[model samples]
Target: MLWFLTCVAALIGGYFLYGAFIEKVFGIKVDRQTPAHTKTDGVDYVPMSTPKVYLVQLLNIAGVGPIFGPIMGALYGPAAMLWIVLGCVFAGAVHDYFSGMLSVRNGGASVPSITGKYLGNGAKHFMNVFAIVLLLLVGVVFVSAPASMLTNLMNDQFNLGITMTAMVVIIFAYYIIATIVPVDKIIGRFYPLFGGLLIFMSVGLISAIAISSDHSVLGGYEPSQMFTNMNPNDLPLWPALFITIACGAISGFHATQSPLMARCMENEKNGRFVFYGAMIGEGIIALIWCAIALSFFDGMEALQAAVANGGPGNVVYSSAFGLLGTFGGIIAFLGVVILPITSGDTAFRSSRLILAEYFNMEQKTLRNRLLMALPLFVIGGILTQVDFGIIWRYFGFANQTTAVMMLWTATAYLVRHNKLHWITTVPAVFMTSVCITFILNNSQLGFGLPMTLSTITGVVSAVAIAALVIIKSRNSGEVDSEEESLQS
Candidate 1:
């Protein structure tokens, strides 16, 4: 209980303390004109109030990642909690703030463009394909998961006889509409409502846990089991836990989502509140779910059995219905549905922007938006036909790998300015190690190398990359001159 409360407080405190420090390091300009005003395309680059942007940004990144990822991570015991709190504060929020602000600095450029600007053209080329495919995977994964859930709920409750296929089509159609419309049209207006449902559901769950008669509701903090790797499958704790809990801790996927809001933000000052604050909000949701999962089913053994039976979705359903009752269950169900749909839409939208930026095509006209969006949706629609279970497994690693790249990009940005580069440098190297080690050790992804060899190789590779980046930054040019010029 003490550990749980401390984690919660740390996340909140981290925001005011560390979040402010990051803002100072990035050097926010209150009077600077944002892309929303300078670019003003009416389609994507539209100025929005701080509150609306924050809510939209929150929902955009808050998909099932936090809820589902943390639940899965809970299988690894309280070590998951430590990762979530620390990772969100130090790694995730910083990555998000810089990704968004960098885009703002570069006229709301996509992640690939921003990466290319700092990391060079090779990275830009790689991220072009890498980011789009990742977005497509995110779109498809969110589509299938929610379609299945909505199908079950509707068929069970209203006997609507809605098949998953039909739901997929309906969702795809909505995604198309959401992808092409102006920022203020559907997403901007309705997302606050969706965000409301999400917050309501989270609050209800927290209340249920608080008032429960069971003394074990927050009982995962037993010092004996706090740091233990309690996975039923005996999975190694290092890379797997990090990958499994990406969003609650840190996710590269948020890098893709941040630019959408970056283009919409009216001021640089709001970047911390929207980007860092939203990630913290996600951490809170993840913390709640992880704590509940630890004690909801009597013990770690029972939690394992429940998860094994039906995955995290089952756990989400059981907890909502079991604790919050029928009405709250329905709301929780809608929140679940809203989470992925919101993200999937933005996934497609972000892809459209990426393609537009790649080709130097203007998107002011409907035809241009359609031209960019149609092919991507066609490919996405086709992918819906294939089973994603195997492909989705790679997303965890891919997502973190993207984060590693973004972190390195931010590290380079700080290094170029001759500021304290360690803020992003440490996390960048750490995540680089996690990604390299995970792929090598996991049979499904890489060579299935021995764990010891993989760990040693990952650490060595990360250190080599860090040293290389530092040397390159020193030789690149007069960073001090560039910094002064930018300030002027």
Candidate 2:
């Protein structure tokens, strides 16, 4: 409980302190015209209130990743708390802030374009394909996971006899409408309510923990526990914990989602509150879920068995229903359901935007919007038919790899301007190591090297890349004319 409170405090402090420094570093132009005004098309680029943009961005980057990922990461003990707090403050929020701000600075370009601008044309071409694939997989995963949950919830709770296939069709239909419609129409209007539910769920669960009579079960942090390998499977903490806790800690996927809100932001001044603040909000959710998971099952042994038996979904449902009571639990359950659905809609919407930008297609016409969106859905719909279990394993790596690219890109941006570059460069190198070690150590993913060798290679490779980026940035000329104009 002491550790949990401290982590929560640190996340909030991070927003005010470190987040402000990032905003200053980016040099927010208060009077500058944002893309929302310059590129307003009443569809993707409409200006929105800061509150709405913040909530939408919150729901966008956050899916089930915060909840499920932390629940899984909790298997590692207090070390999970360490990652969530430090990683969110230093790595995740900074990454998110830059991703959105850079997009805002570049007429709401997608990750591929942003990376391409900094990393080069080759990177641009690669990220175009890489980002689209990641978004599609996210779209499909969100669709299937939520559809199945709704199907079971309706069946078991209300006996509505809703089939998963029917639910999938319903979700996909919503995704299409959400994808093709104007920003202010469906997503802009409804996402705040969904975001409210998410907050309500988090607050209610935390209140439950606070009021519980038994404090011992909630467990305070211990120094010795930090080094203890509490994972039931004896998984190493270095790479496995980092990958498992991506969303709550630092995820590359957030970079893909940032541009959506980047287009809607009315002012550069609100960047910190919207982008970095949203990541902090997500870190809070992740912390609550982790704490609850650590204490909910009586012991780590039972928690592991339960997770193995029914997966994180079962654990979430059971915990919410048990702690929140019938009425509160129902609302909380709906919140969980909303997480993926909201993210799924935005995932598809982002895909459309990225594709439109990639092809230089005009999205002003409803016909153009449909043309870009229809194919993505068709591909996504077909992908829903593949073995999801197989595809999901690759997503973690792809997600982090994209993050690495964005971090390096942000580093390059700073270096080109002759400002602080280490802020991004350090995390960039760290996550590069995490991704490399993960793939190398996992048998199905890489060469199945031993953990020590994988760690060594991962660290060495990341350092080498960092050195090259620093040297190249020193040799690199100036910020592009377009970028200078945007910043000015």
Candidate 3:
């Protein structure tokens, strides 16, 4: 109870502070001339009302990753949940808020373009490669986790391979829709419905779980007990906290969101509503999932057994509805479908943006870009058919690495612009150091020397890029002086 209270307080306090000081005081303006900026052709870059943009942001940000990441983190202990909730407000919200602002200021530039402009062309290319790899990894992990959950639900209810078939069908349908449909139409209608359903289901489940449980409704086992049974091989609390907070903290997906959603903002002031608002909403969802996991199961082993035998959806259903009777079961079933749909649509939009940028298509028509992105989708889907666990592990590392790179870029921007706001810098430094430590601590190559070497390389790269920017600024100033001398 104390832990949960602390987390809630932190989130509430941080949101106000960030909104007042960072977002409102230090205002960022949207650039209109950039290629990716909204030209309002009614297809790709259609203008939207603030309310509509807010709705879209909610749907795009609330994916299965936020739900399950907290659940996994809860397995570490109740304390883990506290860290996640706090981190979401302090670190995650700030990242999303500023990243979107930065992108908008530079005319809907993606992370790569922003890096290129502020950092350099090489850094831009590095960020692009990083973004693509991160996207692929994130897509695969998210797809597999939900697929596994859905499979468990289908098997339990229908006694067939419905889950596997559904996974394939959903992926196929997504690609087909992506190939055919326009971005604005797809997002404008589908996202709001998806987000609405998620809110309804989450509320329904939490209410049902609280009423049905025999023990104290909100109260659960202690944080210490939650950790005692966890797998020793699992990473420690700090690193695990970092991983769990990945999307909510600083997702690579924000790059996609920046360009896709920025055009709709009625004013630059609304960036706070779009970015910070979406992140807090995501954090609340994570908190609910953590509560459900802890309330339902006695320990990690029981939860694992439930998942292994039945699937994650089974665990969620059993935990949520098992005590509530028939109606509860039905609600759980519907929630299963809603969860994946929310995630699937977000993935579709993200992939579309990536393709749009790669091909440099006019924002007016995305048909060609959609066609080009189909092969990549199919390839990812095929890879999903093979070993998923290996893919998940790799994805975890890749996602964290991408976050590190983005944080480095954000840090550079702050340093160069002399905007070293503690809200951004402190979390950025902690995340970077924790990530580097985790990589080094886990590496098995040559008594950890190889991991240390890699960490040093990454650090050097970040510093070198920042140094070059400073030097370039100095040289440009010098050139202006020399030109003035000649003119005079």
Candidate 4:
């Protein structure tokens, strides 16, 4: 309990202190004309209130990653708390802040465009393809996940006799409409309500956790499980924990989502609140879920076994329904159903925007937006035919790989501007290593090497990448000095 409380407190403090410093480093100013104000296209580039943008951005980056990821992350023990707190403060929020602000500075561009600006056109094209693939996967994963839950919930509680296939078709229809429509029309006006539900669910779960404290709850770190890997699979924490707990910590996927908010923000000052603050908010939610999952089940062994037996979604349903009663049922429905739908819609939308931006295609007209979006959804619909579990296995690595690129791109941006570059550069190296090593260590994914060998190779690869950045920074030239013309 102390650990959980302290982690929460620390995350809050990180917002005002570390979070503010990041905003400062990015040189935010209230008077600058955001792309929303300068380039007002009702479809993709409409101005919105700061608070509203915060919620939309929050809902955009969050999904099952924060919830289920932390649940799985707990398999590595309470050390997941350490990663959530520290990683959220330093890596995740920082990554989000840069991605969002840089997008705003670069004409509200997507990750691939921004990467192209800093990394190069080749890297840009690569990222363009890479990002689209990840988003499609997100679209598919979010679609199947919520649909599966809805089918079960409807059958179990309401006895409505719904099937997973029917649910998928229904939800996929919503994703298509949400993708082609104007942001303010659908996502902007309603995401806050969904965001409110998400916050409410978090609070309810926390209260439930507090009430269940007297049961055979999980205790502090068994000294035996402390530093040596507590992962049930015996994978090292170096990459596995980092990759598993991507949302609360640092994620490349969030960079893709940032441009969505970047196009909607009315002021540069709101960047931290929308991007950095949202990631912190997600970390808290992840921490709460981790604490609950760790305690609600017996020990590590039993928690792992339960997760293996029932799956994360079923566990979420059973545990919440048991703990919070009817309220839990409602919350479970929202968690397992609605939130993922919201995320899927935006994932598809973001992909459309990225491709539209890549082609220098305009999104002012409905026809233009739909023209870009239709084929993507067609591909996504076909992707639904693949087993979702198989799609997710690759999605995780692709997500971290995207993060690695964005971080390096961010470092390059900082260096290009002659600002502090080490902030992103260090984490860039770390996450780069994690992604590379995870593939190398896992046999089906890459070379089936010994864990020790994989770790060394990953670290060496990370260092090489970081060293190249340092050398480039040393040799880099002048900063882009054109500041945004203030409209206010």
Candidate 5:
């Protein structure tokens, strides 16, 4: 009961507090700034109410990744939960908060556009390629994991022979919705509805579980089970931690979502509410997931067995519902479907925006955007046909790597803009160090260290050099005209 209350309190408290600050400090009047281009149509560029914007942003940002990442991260035991919560605040929330504000101030540009201004054309092109590849990887994995869950549910309930039926249904549903609902309308209504459902289900499940289970319920498991159950090479804390934090801590995907939400902000003040508020809400959700996993699984072996027998989705769902009755299970099952849909919508919309910007094409027509989004849908569908669990692991690794890049970029921006306070530096150094330590320990874990240590070291060194160069350029009064404008 206490745990459940803490989760709710954290969410509510964080939302209002952040909302207040953004309004007070940024004076974020939504109507003061117009979108860069006035090609506004009801489909893609419709304005939204503050409440609706908040809801959609929350749903788009929170997803199955938060639930799963924290659970798997628990392999480092309960201690890791501290990192998840704290990291989100200092590293993740800050990234989202500033990224959104920066985009809005710059006429709703994506991460690449922002990078281009500060990092030069070569870096801009690099970021664009990296962002697209990361998006596809994340999109496919997100779609597949939930589809796999639905497939197992169908097989268990109806003895269906089709292993891929669930995946088909998911893709079909997403396509149908994307075609029918304008991106704006989806964000206005469905996003919040989905977010509300997640909170309700999470609270209900946690409360039910806490009420029913005693301390003795999961005693057979030990803390070391998390590390020992996996190949020693695969279980290194630092590498896994780095990977987990990337997906949960900070994500490039958030960069896409931020600009969309920024366009809807009634005032610049609302940026804090919509951006930072959503992040804090996500962090609370992460904590709840960690609590659930720690409460249910006895050790790593048990978690692995469950995953092997039923897959990760089934293991998570079954455990969540284990403490409750059939009613609880049904609620959890529904939440799983909602999870992927919300994320898919966000990804689809973001991908469309990227394409529009990349090709200098207008997004005035629904047909054109849908045509552009078809490739993403197809790729997600094909990925669903493969081993989802393995795909998810790789996605995790990629997520962390991208986060390091983003944090590096954001840190550079802060330093150049003269906003490099102690708060920023501490979290920046913490996350950067976490990534470096993970890379160093990769050899000891025997995970086949695909990328060489020297190469990783060189990359880190290069980022440091780039940061220095940017600082020197600013000091020497040689900053780019656009970057100077952005800071002012």
Candidate 6:
């Protein structure tokens, strides 16, 4: 309980302390016009209220990553807590804030476009393909995850008497429709309702924990029970824990989603509150799930056995069921079902915007929107039938890998402008190390090298990248100066 409270407090307080510091570093200017005001196409670029935009941003970034990821992360015991609280505050929030602010500065551009502008043309082309694929992957995964849960809950029949297959098709159609429609129409209005349920569910679980002795925090591990690598697969804690808890900490996916709100933000000053603030909010929710999964199941051994038996979704359902009775079960169903559906909606929406930008298609007309969207929905449906486990495994890799690219891009932007480049440089190196080591060491992903060998390779790669950042930092300022001279 002590550990949980302290971490929660730290993440919340960091929003004010560190969030403000990063805002100052980024230099928010109010007099400048935002893309929402400048490019009011009324299709993608639309000005939304600060509160509405913030909630949509929060829901867009979170999804099931915080819930399911932390349950799996808890197999490593309290070590996951350290990553959630600290990684979120220092690495994740910083990554999200700059990515969003940079997007706003660049005319509400998608992340890939922003990367290309700062990093180079080569990086831009890579981002074009990479961002689309990642967004589609996110969309498909969210659809299948929630569809399965809905099937189980409906017992193969719903209030509308539709089968699971029908449910999936209906849900997939919603994704397409949501993508084609205006942002203010679907995403802006209902995301707050979905977001409310998400937060309300977390709070209910927390209250249940406070009132029950059986759900004591840290009860699953004592001082000696802590930090000995509790994973049954013997996966090394270094990279696995970091990747396992990606969304709750820092995610490259957040950068992709940031542009959506970046297009709608009323003021540059709101970036910290919306982008950095949303990431911190996710960290708190993840900390709750991690602590609950750790302590709520009696001990680490019990939690592991349960997870192995039924999977992470089982843990979510069972926890909610145990805590709040019938209402808890309903909340659990929503957590597993509705929340991810909303996330899938935005994921596809991001894909539409990215593709339209990539191909230079105008989205002002419904005809253009449908022309692009039909193929995406078809591909998403085909993907749903493929092995989702395969998609999810690659997603974790693509996700962190995307973060590495964004961080490096941010690092370059800061250096060219002669700001604090270290803000992103340090975290970029760390995540680069994690992604490299995971591929080299994890049996499913990499060559299955020995841990020591993989660690050495990872460290070497990080150092090499650091050296490149320094070199780029030196050249960036000169390039900027020349460009300024030319413009002057």
Better of 3 and 4 by lDDT: 4
Residue-wise C-alpha lDDT for candidate 2, range 1-488, written one tens digit per residue: 77788889999999999999988888988898888988889999999999999999999988988988898998998678789999999999999999999999888888898888788888899999999999998898898888877887888788999888999999999999998889999989999989889989999888887787653335654668865779988878878888888889888889999999999999999999999999999999999989888877777887788788767888888888888877888899889889989999998888898899888898988999999999999999999998766656677778888889999999988888888999999999999999999998899878889999999999999999998888887787574843442322
How well does candidate 1 match the true structure in TM-score terms? Answer: 0.96
- The TM-scores, one per candidate, come to 0.96, 0.97, 0.83, 0.95, 0.83, 0.95
How many pairs in model 6 have backbone atoms within 3 A of each other, for residues 3 or more apart or on separate chains, i.e. clashes? 0
Per-model CA lDDT versus the true structure? 0.88, 0.88, 0.61, 0.83, 0.62, 0.84
Give candidate 3's error at residue 3 in angstroms. Answer: 3.7
lDDT tens digits by residue: candidate 5, 172-259: 5764466336766555766667766787777776676566645222243455542342322366564456466444556556766777
Q: Distance (Å) between predicted and true CA of 316, model 4?
A: 0.9
Which portions of model 4 show Cα errors greater than 4 Å? 213-228, 479-488
Global local distance difference test of model 2: 0.88
Q: Give a tens-digit lDDT track for model 1, residues 1-488.
A: 67778899999999999999999988988888888988888889899999999999989998888888989999888879999999999999999999999888888889998888778889999999899988998898889888878887888767999998999999999999999989899999999999889988888887787787763555645688887898878877888899999989999999999999999999999999999999999999899889878867777788888888877877888888777788888898788779889999999999999999899888999999999999999998888888766656877888898999999988888888777889999999999999999889999878899999999999999999999887786576434332221112
Candidate 1 wrongly placed segments (more than 4 Å): 478-488
| lDDT (Cα, tens digit) per residue for candidate 6, span 1-488 | 78888899999999999889889888898877788998888888899999899889988888778888999999987878888988998899999998898888887878888787777888889988888888888998898888777766666224555466877887887888899889999999888888778877888887788789777778546676555677766766888898989999989889899999988998998899999999998999899899879867877678888888767777887788788887666865586466678788888888888888888888899999888888888898898888877998888889899998999988888887878888889999899999998999999978999888988899899889878876766676636431221101
TM-score for predicted model 5 compared with the true structure:
0.83
lDDT, candidate 4, 1-488, per-residue tens: 66788889999999999998878776786887888988887888899999999999988888888877889888888888889999899889999999899888877888997887677788899999999999998899898888887887779888999988999999989998999988999999998888878877888777777767554234545645544567777766777788888877887889999989998999888888999999999899889878877878777787788788856786677667877787676774575466678889999999989888777788888888889899998999999999877887888888889989999988887887777888888889888888888999888777878878888999999999888876675576543443632111
Model 3 regions lying over 4 Å from their true place: 29-38, 158-163, 215-218, 222-235, 307-314, 323-326, 443-488
lDDT of 4 at 133: 96
